[model samples]
Target: MKKLLAGTVAGLAMLAIPAQAQAQDAKGAIQVKLLGTAVLPDGKITEVKTDIVGLPAGTQTEANDNVVPTLAIEYFVSPNFSLETICCMTQHDVDAVSGLTGAELVSDAKLIPATVTAKYHFDLGGAKPYVGAGATYFLWVDVDPGEATLPLGVTKTDLSDEFGFVLQAGFDLPVNDSGLAFSVDAKRYFVGTTASWYAGDTLAIQTEHDLDPWVLSAGVAYRF
Candidate 1:
């Protein structure tokens, strides 16, 4: 009876090995991740289109960094290819850097970076690494004029909704037998926006800026 049980256990182990190998190439898998992301952006003015405020000659601006919660979803089309999208909202403040240091230019500017990516993943031992590129649209939710700008008769501030591109790279490490994993991702965005400040019917300031930002994320992922 002992010998018979041993043989049965060996046969089951052999079958499980082949099944596990086949599962690696299986399609129709979905992964969802809850992540914390840090958004680091450069908001330097590229061109001052209309500066009626009599700005300084060496005026420079920068966007403050923000950390926000993000949710990512992915669908596997093949063993090595997948498509992904993320949802998040972030807020920032545009402040003067060089000419008028520490002066607030725009406050409580809310942004939604809508994005999607087509990723190619490579399995390196127990770690899965991926690279992706995709399109993005920057949607401005709400913006407020800063205290410094309010004194300039500024009644409203608006940022242009722009479309751009993004590049992404990340990796995932499995934790256990369950479908849970740890993921880390980094994305670089090539985007820009036109900032406009208005006082009633007059355009007070309009500047073209490079809103290029690096988004770094890390969190837990579950596959289904």
Candidate 2:
């Protein structure tokens, strides 16, 4: 009876070792991931007004989908808490649609969003799932109103830089005993900006645009 009890205790001790090791491994770890990201626009350009005859009031805008490379770095503050920053730049073609006539005015712009998130991780053996919330600073650049708007005396288009909110959810699955893992993440940004259209030196129209976008990403991560 003594030997049997000792064997059972040894088995339990072995099980406890791995769990303790996992907790120690998770603390203060740094992870970096390179992901392919899809930027999907879910909001619209609103409050557009024009002085041109036949051009309608309340023009709406839509952005085209874009795929780009993304880099994310995370630092574990604890076994269940982390902070991450994701960086990427995307180019989007914007279209101005008339609410009255269904006509479209096309333009293009580039956006660089710096997003920071605080995440809570759920440990699940070899897999870790996380949810996060944060904010983004959107840098809007290279605004060009395509040729379609040039004939209408449009000379320049300006997009305002703005701050936005972000929500994120993702999971990391370890591929081996090494620090390599597979990661899949999704984020939503709630953002809006003002667009000013100019004809030569004069402002033609000023409109508010909502650029809320959904970002989906998948790739490999390495923990160090």
Leading candidate by TM-score: 1
Report the C-alpha lDDT of model 1 over 139-215, residue by residue, as the tens digit: 99999988789889999999999999999999989887677999999999999999999999899999999999999
What are the lDDT scores of the predictions, listed in order? 0.94, 0.83
Q: List the residue pairs that clash in candidate 2.
A: none
Tell me how candidate 1 scores on lDDT.
0.94
What's the TM-score of each model vs. the native? 0.89, 0.83
The window of 10 residues in a row where model 1 has the poorest summed lDDT is 20-29
Clashes of each: 0, 0
Number of the top-ranking candidate, with lDDT as the measure:
1
Tens-digit lDDT track of model 2 for 45-160: 66654544345555566778999999999998877889999888898777655553333344668889989999999998878999999999999868887666677788888888
